[model samples]
Target chain A: MSHPNRLNINVENLAIGYKDRVICQNIDLKLASGELCAIVGVNGVGKSTLVRTLGNLQPKMNGEIQIAGENLGAFNMDQLAKILSVVLTEQPASKNLRVQELIALGRQPYTNWIGTLTQEDKRYIQTNLKAFLLEDLKQRKCHELSDGQLQRVLIARAAAQDTPVVLLDEPTTHLDLYHKVQILKMLQQLAHQSKKTIVFTTHEIDLAIQLCDKILILDGKTNPFGTPSDLIKQKHFEQLFPSDMVQFDSSSGSFKVKK
Target chain B: MGSQRSYSFVFAIIVLALLLAFLLNVSSGSVNIPFTAVLSGMFGGHMEVESWNYILWNYRMPKAFSSILVGGGLSLSGLLMQTLFRNPLAGPFVLGISSGASLGAALLLMGTSMITGFTVMPFLNDVSLVIAASLGSFLVLLVVLLVANRIKDTMALLIIGLMFGSITSAIVSVLAYFTTAENLQRFVFWSFGSVGNLSSRQVALMGAIVGLGVLLSIVSIKRLNAFLLGENYAQSLGISLKRSRLTIIIATGILAGGVTAFAGPIAFVGLAVPHLTRQIFDTMEHRILIPAVFLYGAILMLLCDVIAQLPNSANILPINAITSLVGAPVVIWLLVRKRKMLF
Candidate 1:
């Protein structure tokens, strides 16, 4: 498949970690528009730190990140908000907010000082509501939503934000297999239809491999980014985890436990 | 839309209750001013009795206005604190602002006697005590703001505030031990919290400060609503977390510090009125909650002040005692009835 030349994000020699500690270093990647990329790693391999660094939620320890040729550090919060949107794993403080109201918050960058939604804002929200099949849940409070439903609403919120890039931290977490696949499929469709760059971190390597156009494998030794076929050919997943309990089956593109 | 209609209905009822409580508080004081006299006095009409005029204007009017201001200020502060911390149990005093004010007042009232060799100073009136209290609260607020900028976690900020409060309390205790019986008695009385002791000028000052706080809160309604999604999400939405946090802390300081300076750290109204408004209005939007809490707080404080007056008796109870006595039970009833996590 031929990828578009329009780059949404570019990271060069990026170092991300917490406080004085560095988790990953010398990371370089380029993500283009209309791509669905998944960052797959074992638990605590700095997937979140990398995602947050790219989103500018956490300060990068070193290196430069650029969105549309503008340095990430050069964009103010408001400017960055128009370029990128993020969906976090933590629940909102008040689940008492209505679904539509919560989703409308995506228009914060576009709204006036009081955050009144305009006609264009309403259109964006309506499109997401239809796309995510959230019309029935529009009037319901967020606390009343199931985990899968809430995750979908959050994703819809990010879509309504109308940014060029959307980053999600474990979008399929806390979902059963059916719902997980359903959300992944929806994300895949969103990326393809909107021509937006969609990046998410997940532990579901097998599922991500099936749906994502490109995968970034971080195994503390080799950090490679490529199409699924290329990463599999490079044997990136085989070294993802310790070989004692679970082994990566390259042929099946999955991990199997040793008996 | 249904919730909006219910919010309006509840708002109207609360407004009505507030007016009724205001009239009741203005008329039913120890001197028993007639309802007509109170109404006429309020509107600059001729009064039936001149003494009733004095009582209504010089005494009851200031007290009633102070009650409204204190109530609205404290409740709004509490609402801001709860939102900022994302904790339901947070109140205006959760930052130990009131404790700091108490320490300031304790130092003035107790420490002065130790240094000047006099238990009573003729010049040290309510004004000096208010100044001392304001100084103390503002000092603590400055410290908390400084710490808040460095600490990103709300829970950590809260614990720091509590530590500040404990430190001030320790100093106040040390002061109390060395204070004379007469000076200590004066300090104790100031700590009991009274909305009725303010002169008209002090009431005006309180109104100015609290009005500024309320205005700041109104300006921050959008940022506060964004905060409902927690800090990281809010930041992603273009909210400057540091700026919003600073605005909220300063607003809370003005409201809580101003009220504590004058009303002697009246409790429960700040802590309980926001929860009450949330329960009654059934929405967490700050746009709705800000005005609702303001109105409901004024009503509750007026009602508490009326109850504290003891109805036709000269003896008045401490306003703080009545707030807890009345406010705690209502909150308990709400918890029992709702049977869900309010926060």
Candidate 2:
């Protein structure tokens, strides 16, 4: 923890979208180790695109990304894999994989050529299996896990990678409230305990406000980034939705529907 | 760890089964050779009947080796395709490699006769057929590899393969339509699929190509496991999509195409063996599955060849018919009993 304040992710003037189209622009973020951040916005505001761009899974329309003080483009896939890991919203292609087998894939970067796990790799897997409360379900097939359990498994895999930065897209889309908080709280603890930078796109704005150390509210314009209290004082959340149907109350930090 | 410990036991059983199947295949031909003579002859000892020794060395043994290559190669490629495309239904020929082989074979068999109303190429032989089919499959695979480079979606690439299959099969049908009866019969028999046609040299070449394919697959083992999580996740794990996809496509071509070149299209062996191996291995790690599926496929093919040879009977059955008859029911029973296919 000597470099606990090290800059983990640096983004400046980033624009993300598919070819011939721009989804969002002028996005800027600066995060350090031991912090959990959330990207929050209304639907179609390009939250997932930004997350994918940061992970280099999707190309950025314009701007620069730096991870651990190195240009994102300078690293090859193998080097990038050692430094970062990504989790998408979609389930893995093969659900028949055992839970431990699915999570152990995160160690591919450090394993031997034929992928025989070393003793160090096995220790990482065992720690994550216990950290995610997945020891009982380790032998179960992924298809047999509940949505919350699977989400935990995916996040646990990213944790198992032991990377300095991890990015996820909508890690709690289909979970109930208790599971949603459970996932977010686990991510928060993972960030603080491992001193790793964690970023995720999510829809639970109130929960994000409660758990995240910092929040980026993508509004397709300025795309502001700040602490929850600073963003709340700036009225960023109030501008998120149309005023006619819903309202963001600053004191309570939750949205209210019109009667 | 428990799974890892039990793999040795499962592999030992499969190796034993393969040996038994090989013995059954080499001894059960229509010549009515004694088991003892077959064994001693195989080991370079003298036999009571010299003809039986000739048959064992020159015919049955070669045919059995051909089956090993055909089955092991096809099943390994099928497993690669299944993992590459993330589709459980994918087979070795899903990329249209076999259809291209069929098209090449059809043109050589019937095109010469239909063009001039006579079998002008009287000097034609098996070499010409093998070359034609190999060239056809590689040509189609090259085009598929190019399309794969352009697009990132795997499902679209699979559809393009299906389109290629349709286009090639349509050309084959047209050739079949205008050809003479003798030419048509040759093409039909080729489609019936036989592993008993290879000489020692062709079997050696097939072995070399299959060895190369298996070696590449072994090098790709880590990436193949990465792909089970899909492409984006694989890339995040440091697997280059373009390189891995191209490598897989070329390796599949080498395998399925080489088999079809010597022994027409052998069905059921490729698509079914991987699934069957999974039913026993119960794991998705490619390191364990690759060799397991190959041996299982080899065993299944040897048994199918034995059944096709029909002990003491002069009538030999088409291997394709026997494979389907034997493989489809076992797969169906496994699926029904398990209540789901273990893709």
TM-score (all chains, Cα) for each model: 0.92, 0.94
lDDT, candidate 2, equals: 0.87
Candidate 1 at residue A18, lDDT?
94
lDDT agreement with native, every candidate:
0.84, 0.87
lDDT of 2 at B37: 86
DockQ versus reference, model 2: 0.63
Q: Give the DockQ (2 decimals) of all models.
A: 0.52, 0.63
Give the alpha carbon lDDT tens digit for every residue of B1-343 in model 1: 1122346777778889989999998988788777887898899999988888888888998999999999999999989888877767667676777888888888888988887877657878756776777778778877876676577676787798789878987887888899888888877887899999778998998899899899999999889988988889899989998899888877887788778878887877877899888777777777788999999899889989989999999999999899989877866776688675455
Q: Backbone clashes in each candidate structure, one number apiece?
A: 0, 0
**Best of the candidates, DockQ:** 2
Chain A TM-scores of all predicted models: 0.96, 0.98
Lowest summed lDDT window (length 10), candidate 1 chain B: B1-10
Best by TM-score: 2
Per residue, candidate 2 scores C-alpha lDDT tens digits across B250-316 of: 7787788777877787776777889889878989999899999999989989988988988899889
